[model samples]
Target: MARIPTAELSRYLLSGQINRQGCLRLRRTPFLPRRPPCHNIRPLSTTTPPTSPAVVVVPLRKQLKDQAKALKSSGSSPRKKKKNSDNQTVPGWELTVGIEIHAQLNTSRKLFSPALVPESSLEEKPNTHVSPFDLAIPGSQPLFQPDTLIPAVRAALALNCEIEPVSYFDRKHYFHWDQPAGYQITQFYHPFARHGKIVLYSRDGIAAEDGDRIEVGIQQVQMEQDTAKTLAQPGGVNWLDFNRVGVPLIEIITRPEIHHPATAAALVRKVQMLLGAVDACTSGLEAGGLRADVNVSVRRPGEDKKLGQRTEIKNLSSFKAVEDAIIAERDRQIAVLEAGGTVAGETRGWSLGGTETRRLRGKEGEVDYRYMPDPDLGAVVIGKDLVEFLGRSMGVLPDEEVEGLMGRYGLTAKDAMALMLLDEGGRVEYFYEVLGELEGRLGGEGKGEGSYALLAANWCLHELGKLTEGEDAEPRTGLVTEFVAAGDLAAILYHLHRRKITAKTAKALLWGVFNCEVAPGGVTDAIERGGLWFQELSEEEYAMLADKVVEGEEGVLAEFLRFKQGKSKGYPQGKLMFLVGKMMKMGPEQNLDPASVKRVLGERIEGVYLPQLEGEEK
Candidate 1:
């Protein structure tokens, strides 16, 4: 038997432990072949991030069966599962959870405050956008945000939420190191809307899960002003970013009824989609924008509907992160229960490397929040008339707008949706308006009049979508001003619709203008210049070609006679198209449709490639 290689065999033997990333790495044997080095063993880098304290689960497939056998045979110390006097699991695994999502309201001004100078005008620095009310200096007063509230009210009503007649703004008092004002302006007693549910969908556009069909219950939705962010440091110091200090935000507080992590994730996704569905929201979880604070807890396996001590995971930016944090906390609590230990209630931070939850701090209840009414801004009067006006006048829901566009303009499904998605981006409606005028022009000009909606949709989705998609910046809808005259696009499309020019010709012409290959109108004029026939075959040229063919060979006359008698055989028609192409090659390069060439050639080729060839004996 050959001796084991010392360096290679070192890994399998008991050896000294070397530290790497806080995990133990075994030392390799000093002896080894110098040329062919041991490449298999990699040095563990000490760059792993710190993780949460939790029992690690080793993955072993048959370990559980082995455990059961040992459990059955061994004598062990008693480990008692916690139970109440009546024999119920104390702080039973049953726990309730709810999500409070705070979405920034898109408006020109801040709520209960005047909008600041535009960020573009200010020098590059923080806290520059701060108005008097934002700084919360003595005697600083907040003004009402009417325009901001309109969209907010519209959004809540669209969610099928119940709005209060007399909603009030309140002060959520707290003294965090970041709180310059000593409290945040918020709502508590009565919020703007309540009992709304958002259907959740994932990034892949699939609903994750459902607890209750139709609507998940929302507890309340409040319109409030946001606090400034505290940029904290590791040592002790933290700076303040007041750019977002007084921005208007709407918080939708949910009920503690979501049954699973998947259902919860799905709910958040649907809310995002619905917001998009109405053009009331940008995509969710934008940079330093919309966020959710999740309350997580699990119930016992046998418990019907009981809740356990819930923990809060605050201000997760994305839905997937929320899903992960919830599952981690739930599993951690389950592990504690199974180990004959009790789980404590605390705010948790999620460690991404290993799916586990860490205790960030103790959880806070309503008492800890210490909510009180704001002194400056009084109760908002949400009267019956105001509610009716706001609800009815909020603007059409996105799905409804899409349907209306489709119905009014006869747009295809893809085109209609694209228009609604454009929001403030495109001149979508203006395109349809021009289509109406084109029909009149076509009738007078004796051109084919295809349906304008289909044509417009084709132009917008297929042509324009491709034309502008990779632009360095967002395409300007205002660029429609250049196209408003109906000279460029209208002329090209009209020519095609009239069948005066083929689609290939129209497309080529449009591309030429767009690419500056030709002046915008240069392509349209070239059609007339090319002389509709491939060439202006003069009478002399035409007669000479026909005479040449007739005199070239007696075999040609025999072939013509065979074709006439329906007995010609062994011929290829594709070659005839090539001949026609050659015949026109020296002619003007008009935008010729290959189909027209095929059509003309079929008549001349006779039964060459057809079932009955020109020389066939049939």
Candidate 2:
């Protein structure tokens, strides 16, 4: 017999053959050494031998290849599935999301140390705010701060969470350069609050339709310490700033009830508003004061009880990032399941501009953390009376303020939400101050009921918001509140309300007040000094002015006629406004109300100009 090569013999061994005993067995060449049997590799069939003497066992790899070949022969490719659109969820799949928000408490001192918290973390020099306890000095003991508990409890109450009478801290053991201590102390076994709910509305600056309401549940609110700020250098070196170390943080964990990305962002915004309302956490994401970690998962629509494996996108800094990351992660998991792959539970990080998340590390279980009660800290206990007192002392929350604005002033839901969410607490105050002045000055004489309040809100939110919006798009309501006093703004709005000044003149007067060109509470004096009063022309005088503008600008009149006859591409209303603008410019010293001018000019174009042009053409 010819000797078989080693490779040929191994191939034959993988493809078993029938022996003389009528059993499948590996065939070895005579020149090759005998190999030990693999007891783990069982036969595919253990039945009695068939009538045929030959038997062959196909390997798993060969079976897969044969199936792939069959698919190719059938003119189908394994990689040709339909792709999903960006905004559409995968068909037959449902997404579930939860967020963990870490908001730095507005406290002057550290949680367990006496280090003074920096007022501005970015402006303060590094290493200057660190305390001996914050650096993990051997003998320093953890002291609980009572003042920090006030804001924490207030936040819990604002979220409608049930306050825990007693809570304890546990040490989560981890090794990292940012944490000088070997373990982090946090509320693990018992959080301070639980079972809260945040009601999100469509008008809450989210992506829901009108009248849509979603209630997201709060799992728990636990107090924890913030880690040090880690700044990485260009050359693999790292700098640790301990200013943030031991800073008080409240980790707000929400239940996996959210189904949409925009809802998750709205929940975060509601929390920010509530916290700011209660004077708890004034710092926002830009200042490293608030951070959100989103957990996203997807499963088939019928699998209500069973959730797919979730991956957490950590440390999202903005509300938009929170929304986009959840969306990207949801799409990613859906694609994995569709492509016949499993989604592993892992931690992920999102790049600022990237569309997908990158794996940070494998998900750590409770055993990995090696959690134990902190020996240095004792249980925290709160009395029922203190909770009641803090609840009573809490300021008007976002929801209450929104409701009040809508009920009292008849403001729309969108307008009410906008007022509450602007510049923390200052925008609302300025609005009320302006309303008060308007109420005193106008006394509901020229406007409808609650119209003064409406006027005040619109000017504060629209005009002032636009004027104060600098390069970064954040409204400098503080600067507006500082320079443009409520009385000054109210004075200008008062003149506009009484028809003494046109809207254009009112806006110019506001700009003067905002830029400090007008003296405080001297809007009347400025209007008098500049003779900025509305020129109230009678109907006859207005028609004369309108005719003067139309006859002088024959080209504009022809265009207006063309537009009116549907032969032009421009807006007839715009052309009419152009005529009104020309007429207004003719009397620059007298502030003309554009509304009156437009009305008069529109009548001339329709009642007089169009008939003349049509008759001339005929």
Each candidate's lDDT (Cα)? 0.59, 0.79
Residue-by-residue lDDT tens digits, candidate 1, 503-590: 6566666655565565654556767775532323344454344333334334544554555556867554545555456544533335
lDDT of 2 by residue, 1-618 (tens): 444344443233322332433233456788987787543332122232375232344443455568667778888645643323235355688888989999999899889988888887555776678766787765568998878898899999999999999999999999876787878889988999999999888777555431377788999999999988765433443455677889999999999988777778888888998888888894766446789999999999776578889899999877767877888899899889889999999999985534678999999889999999999988899999999999989867788889899998989998888888776667888899888888888874856757677878889889886666656344443456777888899898888888899777888888788777898878999988998777687888888877877776767778877887789887766666777677988755364567788887877888998798888989
Model 1 segments more than 4 A misplaced: 1-99, 115-125, 141-143, 197-213, 229-239, 256-289, 292-304, 307-362, 404-419, 422-455, 458-618
Top candidate when judged by lDDT against the true structure: 2
RMSD to the true structure for each prediction, in A, is 19.3, 19.1
Candidate 1 has its poorest 10 consecutive residues by lDDT at 81-90
TM-scores of all candidate predictions against the true structure: 0.56, 0.78
The C-alpha stretches of model 2 lying farther than 4 A from their native spots are: 1-88, 206-211, 303-305, 444-446, 468-478, 549-589, 601-618
